[model samples]
Target: MSTPARKRRGRRAYIAGALAEEQVARYYELRGLQLAHRRWRGSRGEIDLVLRDGDAVVFVEVKSAPTHARAAESLRPAQVRRIMMTAQEFLGREPRGELTEMRLDVALVDGQGVIEIVENALSDF
Candidate 1:
């Protein structure tokens, strides 16, 4: 069951997330990376953004919160696993398949719309 307040909150969150993703995508695009996909979903989970830097693939997860640190902390371990699984599924479609060079990044957006990108944030996971 969903209440009106809950629904409103959910809608607000969705809008915020969309805006955050857009900001992150632009950030990468300005860096010369071409946008490959936005909100790309696989059987495992959804990847917020996917970009191509020459021959390498970059998977980005966007998080928004009142502060950059809070946004960064929002990514849970379980989510990391799901993102990894989804990234693998995404790679399966590439011509190089599993051999395709890729990296997972986390983009954090604060309420003030400040952006901070952490490259290879999921490599250890």
Candidate 2:
């Protein structure tokens, strides 16, 4: 059980995360990427954003923190693994899965609510 203050903080965090996702989605949309899904969930975990980038499918993991570095650092290996698994599940259900190129991206949201998208961010991982 959580105290009232803790509960409030948790709710605040959830709201912040959701808003961050929306901002990131809009940022991608402005770049000509069409949003395929938001908060797509599977048995493994949830993908923050799924977008169609031309002939490629992009899976974006959004992180929000006090700073851009902190936001980027928040994506841990375990979380990446979970996101990857969920992405695989998402692709499996798509009819054009094999035909489309896949990409993993990260969107970092800073304290000022600025979004910085890093494409192929997980490629070397």
Candidate 3:
């Protein structure tokens, strides 16, 4: 079979991403953290979302791939570096905030419309 042309992400993928982001936000909200930002942008990079979990400041990275493996895999080394740098820039803008409690988190998506939140999965940054 002629390899069925790989389906590029279109409206459906966009919808999935949006839905995942929203669900992640809801989860963080229920956990007592306020969703301070959604799709926050900076010169260095873009942060998917930010939440305040009590005294903690969380920088969220939301990934919505077809499967959990693919989704989690997307957060490769390069991407992590960018996210970290971007987070630094993001924090620079809010110097008054508590930088000591800053953290980076990932929200991975599966094909079943489920989101798995992985907190501090990476130790590097």
C-alpha TM-score for every candidate:
0.96, 0.93, 0.83
Model 3 poorest 10 in a row by lDDT = 1-10
lDDT scores in order: 0.96, 0.91, 0.81
C-alpha RMSD by candidate, in order: 1.3, 1.5, 3.4
Predicted candidate 3 versus true structure: per-residue lDDT over 24-109, tens digit per residue:
89988988899988988887778889888766679999998878889988887887887888878877767464454788989997
Name the better of 2 and 3 by TM-score.
2
**Segments in model 2 whose C-alpha atoms lie over 4 Å from true places:** none
Off by over 4 Å in 1: none
Q: Report the Cα lDDT for residue 33, model 3.
A: 91
Error of 3 at 109 (Å): 1.5
lDDT of 1 by residue, 1-125 (tens): 56998999999999999999999999999999999999999999999999999999999999999999999889999999999999999999999998999999999999999999899999877
| Top candidate, metric TM-score | 1
* Model 1 deviation from native, Cα RMSD in Å: 1.3
